[model samples]
Each structure stands twice: as structure tokens, then as C-alpha cells.
Target: MLAERPWTGYGFESFWGTPLLLNQDQPFDRAWDIRTIVHGHNGYLDIAVLMGIPALCVAVYTFLVAPLRDYMRIPLRKENIHLGDFFMMVVLFAALNAFFESFFFHRADPVWLFFVFGMFGLRQVSLRPMAVRGRS
Candidate 1:
């Protein structure tokens, strides 16, 4: 599918709405059907197919890579460690879930919302300096 439109793609809803797949002259003996496919089932691939590879790269970097890097740099305090763990879990959940679901970047998706909230929380936690509890 990407080979057909690597850059511009077939546009949104192409997964099910595209005549490209529906119009295929498949043999009558075919076990499965393309029309049954509603989504790419992989969030990253869906974005790449619907948007483009560049958009997929940007989305992955923005939502997963950068935030994970930032969270890793956070100081290892009791509270900070907990925050990092929470962030890690959220990131992992979203990342792993994307492998089988097309929920990434969906505004109304609860998982996507939680992922965004986790990213925002990580940003706030990474910004504010950890208090120097023992310092004068």
C-alpha cells in the first residue's frame, strides 16, 4: 500500500474507503477479503500509510523517543524515580498498544489521552528543579 502512495498516501479513511482495494479482481476461491480490513491495525503503519513516513517519524520521535530521553535524564530521587517509572509504564503501554491498535493521536482515545498527559507530566517534572533537601 505504501508503495502505491509513499508520500501523499490515499488520504484518511483509505484503509476501508479506498476503491483501490475494493476494486481488486480477486479470485472467487480467495479465503480472505480486503473489504473486511477496516484499519492497518498498526498505529505507526496507519500513520505512515495515511499521512507519510516523515509524519510517522515525527510522531514517533515527538511522542515516544524525546519524552523517554527526557525522563531518563531526570535525577534519581525517591519521587523522581516514581515519576520516571510511571512515565515509563505509560510510554510502554502506548508504544506497545500501537503495535496492534490504531489509537495513537486519536483525540478521543483514552489511551492516547493518557499518553499525552504522561508526556506533559514528564515535561513538567523534568523542568522544575528537584529540591535540594539537605542544602542550606
Candidate 2:
């Protein structure tokens, strides 16, 4: 059982237990990236890129779609928000992300998981029926 332990010191090269993105002296390449799966460290930039996609999706729906309904005189909050539609969109985005990741990267990265969860929250917030008060 002792043989199972990683003694090459390649296990933990960074803070805590995980390596700092790639090893300190490793080089990054597009061709290599296309062939292998290695988690690289982008610091906080990675977080922004991962979180930005769902936020932009929600922002577009809110600022563009929601306001257009107002100009078109569509009812704002009268009818209940359709739960099925919201759930379907979230599933669609998640599936798309998964399929693309699997095809190109050969594995579903944790970033995709974050995008899926973020999409759910975004749709729920954007599709919520807001109460509109009448003009006094």
C-alpha cells in the first residue's frame, strides 16, 4: 500500500495541497493544452472568466429582454413566471457546456460546474415576476 503514495514531490507544489496552477517552472503551450488536461493557475483572473459568462447571460436578458417588454406594453407581473421554461434553459446551457468540454478538452472541468450553477441562479433572478405599480 505504501507504493500508492506519490513520492516524486509532484503532488503538492503550491500553497496548501494543490499545485499553483502548473508547476512553477513548467511551460504552457496551445498544442500541449489541446492534448493534455492540466490545471493552470490564473489567480483571480480565472475566477472572473468563469463567473463572467453566466453573469453576462443574465445581464443581457435583464437589460435587453425585460425592458423591451415594457415598451411593447407586455404585462409585467400579472401572469406567473413559468417554472418549466427556466429549468429547461438551465439544463440546456449545462448540457451544451458539458458536451463542448468533453469534445474539445476530453474532460469536464470544474469551471463548467460553476457555470451550470450560476446559470440557474441567473435565470431564476431574471425571470422573476416583479410587481409593477400603476402610474399615480
Candidate 3:
């Protein structure tokens, strides 16, 4: 299905919902049945299959790259270090989980919510100054 339309993709929920799209010519001895699979089980592949490679690229940057860049900039001070560390763990957890689960951008999902929250926290921490000194 993805091979047939790599650029355009099969659209949302088309993976298992569209049986006609599956390769009907496959041998009966095949190990896995494409029809039985609902989601790609991988966030990146799900995005590519649901939308397209372009959308996958955008999602990758938005969800992974941008947040990581912000995380790197957050100051490691005693006051805000915990904030940065906690959010970093959340980002890492989401990133690692994306490989095994397809819950990347689901707005209602807790994983997605925490991931977004982590991004927001990282951004806020990155933007603020580490310390301030008063002048006489």
C-alpha cells in the first residue's frame, strides 16, 4: 500500500480499512497478513502512510528535532535544571516510544499531551535567563 503511493499515501485509517489496497497476489504462506494490521505500529511510518513523506518530515522536525534543540539550550541551573531534566526525559520517552507505538500526534492521548507539555516547558526554560545579579 505504501509502495503503491509513497508520496500521496493511503490516507488516514486506510491501512486496514481498505482491503482492496492490500496486495491480493501475495502467497498464502506469507508470515504476516497485511489485512490484520491496523496501524503501522510505528509513529513515523504511520504518519507517512496516513499522510505522506513530506508530512512525516514536518512531524519529525516539529515533534523531535525542534524540542531537542530547545532542550539543549535550557540552562542546567539548580532552580530550572529539574524542569529541563524532567521535560528531557519526557521528550526522550516519547521519541523512543514512537518507534514501537503509533501515538505521536494523537491530541487526546496522554503520551501526546505529555510530549507537547514537555516541548512547551523546554521552550520556556530555554528562553529565560539562568541567573540575575542586582547592581548597587
Candidate 4:
């Protein structure tokens, strides 16, 4: 129960340490309680069914479009289109967009669409000069 001490004292430091039901005589079993089981199942189902598509879209755009934009922007030799650069761009874009969406939009899934568009727009702007210079 809520009033009972946690089996592992480590959780006692936080508000989550407080149990929902306070019955001092009841023991905290290692088995999943009804409430915990239901909540976790529902949460997993929601994420998998509702949020999975957008998350996948974000991941693909971060790995594909972002790097293509960077490649078009940087001036490199004809053979310098390395996979490392693309991978780094993907990681950077993912981290940047994740932080921005988490802190600012409070939605980590759909915000990558904005980043994808913005990156493509910026790439277009940057590509003008390179195209005119016979580079791209």
C-alpha cells in the first residue's frame, strides 16, 4: 500500500515512490498490480498504433532528406560523397529535432515534417549559387 515502505528504497526519493493505495498492512509484491498492468498495456498500444507512423516518418526524413540537403550545400570533390557525412547529418538532425519538438512543441512525432520542409527550403536557397557556379 501507499503507506508501506518500498521494497527497494531507491524509489523513495521521488513522488512516484508514493503508492496509490495506502494500506500499511499490505505487502508490495513484485508481481504487476492491476492498475500498473492496465496502464502500461494501454500506453504501449496507443504508442504503437497511433504514434508509430509519425515517429517512423520523422526517422526516415532525418536519415534521408537532412543528409541530402547537407551534401548539396557543402563543397566537396566529386568523390567526396561519403556515407559518414550522411550518417552524421542524420544523427544531428534527429537530436536537434527531438530536442526542439520535446521542449517547444511537446510532440516529438510530427514535428519532423517541419524540419524536413525547412531543410529542403534551405537547401534550395543554398543550392542557387552552387548551381549557377556549375557545382551542383
Q: Candidate 4: which stretches are off by over 4 Å?
A: 1-49, 62-66, 69-118, 130-136
Once fitted onto the true fold, the runs of candidate 2 whose alpha carbons sit more than 4 angstroms away are 1-35, 38-91, 102-129, 133-136
lDDT by residue for model 2 over 1-136, one digit each (tens)? 1132323222322222234333444456533532233323432222223334444355345434543343234224443334333534554454444434432122475654544454454455455565556789
Q: Provide the global lDDT of candidate 1 against the true structure.
A: 0.80
Candidate 4 per-residue C-alpha lDDT over 26-117 given as tens digits, one digit per residue, 9 for 90 to 100? 44874644433211222212222333545435644654566666656655533233433444454456445453333212245454455454
* Top candidate when judged by TM-score against the true structure: 1
- Candidate 1, 68-128: lDDT as tens digits: 8878777767777777778778877888888999887678989999888888878776766
Error of 3 at 113 (Å): 1.4
TM-scores for candidates 1 onward, in order? 0.80, 0.24, 0.77, 0.27
Candidate 3 or 1, higher TM-score: 1
**RMSD to true structure for each model, in Å:** 3.6, 13.6, 4.5, 13.0
TM accuracy, model 2? 0.24
Candidate 4 or 1, higher lDDT: 1
TM-score ranking, high to low: 1, 3, 4, 2
Clashing pairs in 2: 21-40, 21-41
Q: What's the C-alpha lDDT at position 135 in model 4?
A: 54
